[model samples]
Target: MSDSKHRHKSVLKKTDEELLTDDLTHQLALHTRQGHNKFLSESIIPLMLCFACPFFVRSIVFICDHCHGSIHEFLQRLLFDHTLTLKDVLENFFFFKWHWPSAIIIIGFLIYAIIMTMLLPGDEYQGPITDTGHIPIYRNNGFCYYIVSLIIFTILTVVLKLNNLSPTYIYDQWDAFLSTVSTFAFLLCFCVMIKGKYMPSTNDHRSSSNWLTDFYRGVELYPRIFNIDVKLITNCRYGMLSWALLSVIFCMKTFELYGYTDSALITCILTLVYLTKFFWWESGYMKTIDIIVDRAGFYLCWGCLVWVSGIYTLPCYFLVTHPKQLGFQLTILILTLGLLSIYINYDCDRQKIQVRSTHGKCLIWGKPAKIIRAKYRLLNGKESESILLASGYWVLSRHFHYIPELALAFLWTCPCGFQYILPYFYVIILFILLMHRAHRDDQRCRLKYGDAWIKYCDLTPWKVWPKIY
Candidate 1:
């Protein structure tokens, strides 16, 4: 009887496996068919529609707020009555044709992609499920879509370069093209990707006052598409887009400086490298980091990459290409600042991670305290815990990482030469954003740690910049 029961259990397990395998195979075949059909539909689409986008944008020169009057009346008022100049007309034309439309289209596509991807079919059989008790197949699809978009955008950029289009021409138009295509591709792939669950479902409620509940709530607002949560919006799309846009601007400025030089190539390479890094860090790699910190969002990462990295480093390329235009002393100073800032930032992160690994708890001053509980989901739906450390660098300052970050920003913006308002805009923006982040963080900590946080704050009072905030 005992032998028969054991054999029955083994047979049931095998049956489950067979069922899962068949389901997966059927889904794969369906996806292949769908892909072929999609490709055919796209190929048969009219070429005129594809080519006519630029011209169509150019033709619809004016966009009017249709509150009381028609577009014709609005244009007449602005052009004739307002005495708008040719420059004004040109500025409005580009802004409408590219800037506004691109922003709307990209955002719309991302949202739609995320939603559709979640609703698609698939299941989790191999890995641990997420909070929804399913594998994160949608999140994987979102990542794939983002990668495809980036490749498409890069190709378009290369094509523009090959055509010898003036920097100004590319700058004013390429963004729109990239944005449109990326958004479209994201939507396309999102519609077809297989689904999987990353978290198992559990109804065991130990208590209503669980700390994990608060954390989960926080994660919800952390900004995600479908069920895939991306913690850092600024670092991913925003940062990459900012760099691309800055590259266009830099190219124009570089042309004005040394005509055409190898410096331009260097700048392009660096920009691409940074963009690639942004994607890598924002994807599953960052998700792994979340497992450690238990803070799975990209808010801080996004802010650093987009506002800080994009605004600062990208402009330096232009300055390097045009040393004479920016002056010698200023250039050297900017480069020095950037190098130092990067060094400090890396050091801080390295120290923090090392500290966490070696010590089971964070050490403030010389005293060690137990903190940072690890939470995981198992098949039977129960919580488990393990110890995490914070000994080395974290003992020094609560947020030593913020120092290099601010420094890097200051260094990158230095090359703008303080000649125009746009150049220094980065510095102003970073200061404001960081300050806001610091304040928000403070509030969160205050709520989370209560007396324990108060003690931590007492030990290390400097939020970001030491002795400044």
Candidate 2:
């Protein structure tokens, strides 16, 4: 306990630069001895809190009297009237909602995604090495698959509408989607708890003896079911596909209700384009922090399955009911600005990737790319070399890419106007997410690159914003 206390104090005594560099990397030693699962208590709790969002969205946004209504009443009564016991709270929210139609939809979609993954044209990418000696290879066909899926979806929608056979009640799929995904997550957890034959991820800490913690952390680094990569299927195909489709449906519903309004249209167009861009840059994403560092745990799996499709569609989701007509001039300006931000972000990422690919031999902004050679040790003890580009957008701010990305998110979100707080939820979340990611990436490099990281940080001082942050 004394040693742990001293270590914590010593960390606090470091300089601001050192602190920023070392932030989030140093896991404080726990004084209390616990099972392996309990070791991740710090991480698991935050993830659990994030879990609340799905239920909140499903219950509140898409209100069902049987489920959320009772829960809300219970909460209000407890807060303003009487105290509630633990059993009361659990019982209040524990009714099963079996939307048989949505079940078919979810199952059919999964089957469709698997078929598309098999048929689509994609390059096999070798990711960063893993604890298991095998290097992870993923088939990235999201762009082609998404395009084909969208076309087929459109044709079906059109065909059904012409014959007046369209499934209108399908609009209520959000609640059902939430319920079905929750079941999948729980079942996955149970599977992970019992199955030890799979290749589990190896990390700094030992495996937790606690079943729930082990399940929460995941039993496999990469779980393959019926020859499908769970991460790729859940994160890219199911989540991204659902998010995009939901936005489309919301916009269509808005048009059906209020003729044609530019506000909803603008949001819809930007969202579709943004999602398409994501698919186009799918390979680039395969090497990101989420895929490379994060385990295939509940944080990621449930997030991609449930939270992503719900929360990410908020801007357009709100617009479905509250359609406003922004004039042509304002619409043009917003679109122009958004497209520009998207371009800047894409180009910035392209420059960094190209320079690294070319070993700093390429030109950046009409000048030779300048970079500091930095070496880092992988989690598995293998050494890797990377050159930090100090020229172009990176020199302006270490995370200049985030600025344009933020701009892009904000401009699209502006269509919601100042009338309601719900639409701007994405903008606020994006800001926090970016800032947190910047800190995490910096800390990771500080641990990995050591002195080389310090030098790199010195060269480009500003983390994101110009001279402010």
Best by lDDT: 2
Q: Once model 2 is optimally superposed onto the true structure by TM-score, how far is the C-alpha of residue 326 displaced, in angstroms?
A: 0.7
lDDT of 2 by residue, 1-469 (tens): 8986576667756653454344232222111112244445745664565456554556444422232324455566556665655555443333335567777887788889988998887878876654323467778788999999999989988998999766434555655656766666656556643543334433322244555555565555566666677778878988898888888888887778788989988888888888888888877777777776555666678778767776788777777666789999999999988888888888888888899789999899999998999865443445667789998999988899999888888888888888556567678888998898887777666655678888888888888997986
Cα distance off (Å), candidate 1, residue 234: 7.6
lDDT of each: 0.42, 0.70
Error of 1 at 382 (Å): 8.6
- Which residue window of length 10 is worst by lDDT in model 2? 25-34
Per-residue lDDT of candidate 1, residues 1-469 (tens digit): 8985575444434432232234332222211222234334333332333334333333222221121213455457667777656676555433333355555644654464445445433332222233324333223333444556556556766786789743354334443544343333333222211111122122211111322222221222223333354443333444455555456456655665567543353344444443444443333334332321222212233223322333454344435323334445655565556566655555555444444456544454456643454343332444433333233444445656656666665555454444434434455666786677566556534432345456667666667655766
Candidate 1: stretches off by over 4 Å: 1-162, 166-168, 174-238, 241-249, 256-333, 356-396
Cα RMSD (angstroms) for every candidate in the order listed: 16.4, 5.6
Off by over 4 Å in 2: 1-40, 43-51, 59-96, 131-134, 189-206, 379-381
